[model samples]
Target chain A: MSTTPAFKRLPRAVREQQMLDAAVRVFSRRGFHAASMDEIADDAGISKPMVYAYLGAKEEVFIACLHREGTRLMEAIAAVVDPDLPPDEQLWRGLRAFFGFVGAHRDGWAVLYRQARGEQPFAGQLAQMRTRMVEVVAGMLGRATAAEGREVPATELDVMAYALVGATESLADWLADHPEADPERTATRMMNVAWLGAAELLRGNTWHPSG
Target chain B: MSTTPAFKRLPRAVREQQMLDAAVRVFSRRGFHAASMDEIADDAGISKPMVYAYLGAKEEVFIACLHREGTRLMEAIAAVVDPDLPPDEQLWRGLRAFFGFVGAHRDGWAVLYRQARGEQPFAGQLAQMRTRMVEVVAGMLGRATAAEGREVPATELDVMAYALVGATESLADWLADHPEADPERTATRMMNVAWLGAAELLRGNTWHPSG
Candidate 1:
């Protein structure tokens, strides 16, 4: 063997991926500030400097984790939602995908939604992610309403989108505490709520006791 | 002059209350770890040792704030919820009170909900508050469904409560970002969703489109 170092490690790209996986697990548990680069490196079975070299600083690691997890979540919903399907079915598909994603990746959802809030440097980035999420729902809501020739005012549309997203996120946090609850059951329950909620709003149906 | 200081000069109870108020403000903004007892004492126009004397420690101060705010929020809701009112009206009343209180005492709500989540010693207390909230909604749901001669399944009731509470909390967060949104409007939108959503679920009326 040559005098130079003989035992080479994994490539930079693979190491970066490992570091991100470690970061997500750590960040989700400890939140951002409490989670350290050294812990992430130890979790990844690599040295701290090597992990830094692949993932930059701690903030970059967090951003990278969010980007990956966010993309995965968005794609999960997009994959389930077929434009060719009817509006209601499309909405159902999206809600199901969302609840399912949260059920499966509770940690990732927590890190993105709960842990990401309150911090300054990441707050803007979190806001951007939230905007992207709201836009996706708003687009779907607009399309669904338009397909029925119903015109939902822009402001109402925005409120509806926020309500839907908020309800789902809240359910996710509750689900985290109640792990005994089945994911399918949870998703169905949410789907029922979302479907009924969206339909009533779209048709301008108001709830009052029978008079 | 009396050797003892007059109540006007500063009673212990008054000083303690002042310290608690200052602690709430600082802890709400900077969270538990970031907030210092010195700053809290300064904010209260007292010395650091006094803060320690009244509150014991930083964590103790945070727990005290949580208990105080949690009690205030629960009391606000209880004060608004009239036992004699119809279930739907009772829910509407509760929602209005909730949104109104959140809008008015935002710092308290932030301390109770956001900052309290990260700290372990306080999470149990926060969960207690959450349980009380869920119980409030569950009681309403139970009463609403009682007239139909059948109880809503506890699981389903839990899910509905989560959705309503989640929507309200989410709306509160959204309202924080967009202050122009009127509290009345926010309350109305939330009530509309809750009352309508609850109605459909109670009737077992799933909103699936006709195939």
Candidate 2:
């Protein structure tokens, strides 16, 4: 019988990432309470103790997954946005990148938004992440309006940013159910609502900025 | 000492609703897997057998809760929208009702969106409810644009409806964090995005629609 040699061992950083990847997949599917470290270890093709050694507790593993996935999503959006582009164009690209990322990495998005946010124990941490994300989006909206040479109220911009983010998220949820739709298609749909509505706001339409 | 009845004598429909209300609260808080039937019974001020008899099984109880809550939400939206009013006015009323319902019944909203959508068996039902909601919004969009003598594509309207729904849901989640914010305020914030973006689309601004 011929014996296959074991794959070469990886460094702690690489192994930790591997564990996080597995945890994200499992947690996204089964949620926090239903997911077990043993299942995660099995998914990663690593032993149980090694998963602990690399990732600490289940909560820590979940946090690591959020960090990895959230950062990746932010970077994905950044890659698509161009500062020199027209304001509408920049917003369009960013929305497209966001839906694309969610479509391609559904598991990661689910881990960050659905699983982690649903866990009460992690609510404080999740709130911080949410605030940071909101700030990033608010910053983008501010930049876009500034490019248009319009002085949009920061509060109005903040509300718009929140609405834009929410719309993207709801569309993403819709897309998850109808998997046949392409990410670009989803992004385009979102852009129509976001950019057009945003333009109306900039034109000083009667749309009240309530919250 | 006077004693309350053992819950066995309660009418079936009344008892069922009571159990469902409890289930919604518990399920929303602890999620489906973590929420036990025993605790649900306790929350309902009843015994285990009474709960079981009133609502078939744990899953059945959850489904019952979802159906009831979803119906309540749809009704709220329906009640607020005036068909005779102009499209924009109708949309505003609907948005207000949605935000109002969610603000007052946060647990119901959580159960409908977060817990039910996250749990497996109930996910399909929630998906259907979500689709129905999008359809309603799309229908309204169709009427509004047509009344204004504009002809946006059905696909664009569908996407916009999705974004509108998303904006409402996102505001709902945000309200959980900022408890002091009123429903009217949240509704107004959503209307700013919806009406502005929607009016722009009717005017041929060509904001790229998402998938």
DockQ of each: 0.41, 0.44
lDDT of 1 by residue, B55-120 (tens): 789989888888887788788889988877888778877877778878887766765566665446
Model 2 chain A TM-score equals 0.85
What candidate 2 gets wrong by more than 4 Å, as runs, is A1-10, A22-43, A56-62, A78-90, A110-113, A122-127, A142-155, A175-182, A208-211, B1-11, B19-43, B56-60, B82-85, B110-112, B145-154, B208-211
State candidate 2's TM-score: 0.77
Clashes of each: 0, 15
Report the lDDT tens digits of candidate 2 across residue range A1-211.
3142445334656777878888988987788778899999999999999888777888888877877877887898888777777677777788778888888887667545755554455655665765676777788778876766778878777777778877887887767656677988787778777777777777666565332
Q: Where does candidate 1 chain B have its weakest 10-residue lDDT segment?
A: B1-10
TM-score of each: 0.84, 0.77
lDDT of 2 at A199: 72
lDDT at B88 for candidate 2? 76
**How does residue A16 of candidate 2 score in lDDT?**
78
